[model samples]
Target chain A: MSTVLQSLSTELADAVESAGRAVVAIHARRRIPASGVHWQPGVVVATNHTINRDENITLTLPDGTTAPASLAGRDPSTDLAVLKLAGQSLPVASLRRDAPPKIGELVIALGRPGPGLTASWGVVSRADGPWRTWQGAEIDSLLRLDLAIYDGFSGGPLIDAAGRVLGINTSALARGVPVTIPIATVERIVTELLERGNIRRAYLGIGTQPVRVPESLARKLELKSDLALLIVSLESGGPADRDGLLLGDVLLELDGTAVNDASDVLAKLGGDRVGKPLAARLIRGGQVKALQLTPGERPTSRAA
Target chain B: MTASMTAGLAQEVAAAVDQLRQITVQVRTHRAATGAGILWNGGEPEGPGLVITNAHVVEGERATVELSDGTAARARLVARDLRRDLAALEFEPGRAVVGAVVRDSPPLRVGELVIALGHPGGLTGAATLGIIHRAESDREGRTPRWIRADVRLAPGFSGGPLADATGRLVGVNTMMQGGLALAIPAVAVEAWVRRSQTMAVS
Candidate 1:
């Protein structure tokens, strides 16, 4: 009477039962509560978009007890927020960080929108290399699911068949499409957010748009590429403005890398690049000009 | 070994679906499209069989029930409960039909596999597989109102059987809500059937 089908069902149920121990309902927003994972000791990880207000946040633990939680920090770029829970002996999520989830691998999304723990199973639809989000945060890996996302699915944990946490699921990262923030990215963000209460990135206060450089100008400037980014706006007294970089400068290269798109510029603006002077090559007054522009730490509230 | 195990799983699922299809019947009424019905009770020799479906599927007192083996018969509505969205129909089969084997003990677990057989979009015997989304806790020794599942159910899937992996009937697919399929637990349906049959006898 022992069949693979029955064993599979039992194992799946066992996995949900084991993993549901760490999943809790986060009451941070209106309407139905969202899900969060007890990631580390006294720490819970949830989605930033689900936390509507920072004050008066509470959590319904796996044992069906309500506990007050304080906001530790939030990183909107990764759609992750950390909360500090006190004096609760709850089990932490067992994270599978050694290997990334493969395409077509069986996975389950566990959430506790209310007192009940809900589960939905499916396969990993798309698993690709690292990709950048619209907010310029680089996710460690791209994980697109082929499962039904229920209400309060955001901030829930996507667990493997063995009941190990693969990543945190969020519907806000990919324009409402369900995507998981992998453990590598979550670990990095959790460390940084817990330490500094926010994520830091290097920013140059200027907006750029890709423009086709005139062939005559390209040939005269000895530029290798015919396309360059046109600096359209400059923030007053900002990093680029303070470095004497003018408006309408056709940016050709930054730190020896060709800059043909806005994302190309963002690739050079990681958190480590803050306060570091970068070699800039641009076309100013129909001539190639080189300048050392130091990048400043971006404000938490400012985009780009 | 892995390949055989996977094949075994697939074969077992196919067998379960086939067993469910035998007890599943296509219900047609003059007022609505073709829906599905479960063979609730396959009566004794020379007795009438009982079929259960959604009340919304059968508008009047009469309906046409077509078994999976292509046997068609005129059925009379025995009981209709709009509150529970359940209806019972009685039909005289030419021979003995198979009744659903409902799972009543060892309450369902969350994330346990569940299979649904329905006639979606007029398609006969369509089977879909999913897991139990949330298994309600029966603290008060009462059956939960609705058994919510993650399986997808279309318009023509109303009043079908939602069985477990081993093909035991768990619930009856009633309607869909918030993208989740809601079903009346088989135990609850059994209680309702008992009450209705008692009333009919009196």
Candidate 2:
């Protein structure tokens, strides 16, 4: 090869190598109850609930070595898992701090999409309203990616061009939208899962429905015009029932803060409220009553 | 080795890339749902006839692999390290083929020579060359630890081999940016593969 040609060839080769290293793939095979089976993408962060002895998992690197990864800890409340790799010096992901991704920032999702490490780039289309996931948990903040989320990129990192991870690619909106768990939320969940066996969550065993305070009802009971969490069904031994709460009670406030919606109550109760007392104010039969309830440990489902 | 020898070795290895074809993978149930390509190396699926691709290629799948030649088979998926992104595919049936040797040290400084081989764009056997821009860890960026070169990588180039002027397996061609390509340092991959194998056995 001529000197110039050799130099050119060398430069091209180096570029190919560097770009390949940043790409990582996560894979998982999940068995959904009643749904039969489901496939997951990206690196499988095996949780105690999902990865079992009969299940199989493999982790692949940029250079293409595949190894079976074992299950670590899994906290379903947060949907986080810790996977230990016998492998080391594996290229760690770049974490973005200081500033969260702006709502319109362009981000890239890389994983073994459809079989090999592939890159899918998109912009933040919207950072909007909370949505309840399939697990029946509500997320207050979320990022909407423009690209379509394929099945295999779940646990893979959604990174910026500078290579900082913004979040973990989670699910895609069936309506042509992709969703990722924000890095801040993921960090908190992962930290909790690693430190504790499970995510500590406060629970009130009552099914709630958000009802707009009627003008007539508001006038009769001095209620706000905004939405309020209405107690629908109270579990027999729940904290709300033990705190002298009634079935027809309209929740007005929690912990001295006015409640605007059902999600507001969930936010106050779910995280940072485990094993603590919350003062709940409610209106029953046109009478206002204040009750202090000491929330108890959430009941664990037997499924996982 | 001398610079001339290194250059010659690169040519020899580059030439060998022409004979290499196909990477084997076993797509797990979840991986298969993502709609991935199949590596077809001919012959039987079992025995020594397996394909070898990047470990990431077969993530979320349980699999064993075979090389292009019908002579080698390896047990796959013993252990994996997420930090390094390396996995060891092991099989008891086939003889262990001696893979290409890699240099122990990092690549030469900026503007030095480098080369890569892989099925870029599904081109079963191809060789491309480029120059090193710098020697830096991947932590500074999102790309993997590699020799950042000016090589171009099309689709399907991942898990390919990268060599220095001496034909040593210095890195594994993995990704590309514009015209810049990245390769995982061979020493790093080798070290992790060995370590994962130990854990798989014990």
- Model 2 has an lDDT value of 0.54
- Tens digit per residue, CA lDDT, model 2, A160-245: 64556666665432233457666666666656655664666678877778877777777877765557778888988888788777
**All predictions: root-mean-square deviation over Cα?**
1.7, 17.1
Model 1: per-residue lDDT, tens digit, A109-130? 9999988899988999999998
Name the lDDT value of residue A80 in candidate 2. 47
DockQ, per model, reads 0.74, 0.03
Output the lDDT of residue B134, model 1. 94
Task: Please give the CA lDDT of all the candidate structures.
Answer: 0.91, 0.54
Worst 10 residues of 2 chain A by lDDT: A33-42
Every model's TM-score? 0.97, 0.50
In candidate 1 the C-alpha lDDT for residue B176 amounts to 92
Please give me the DockQ of candidate 1 compared with the native complex.
0.74
Off by over 4 Å in 1: A302-304, B31-33, B42-46
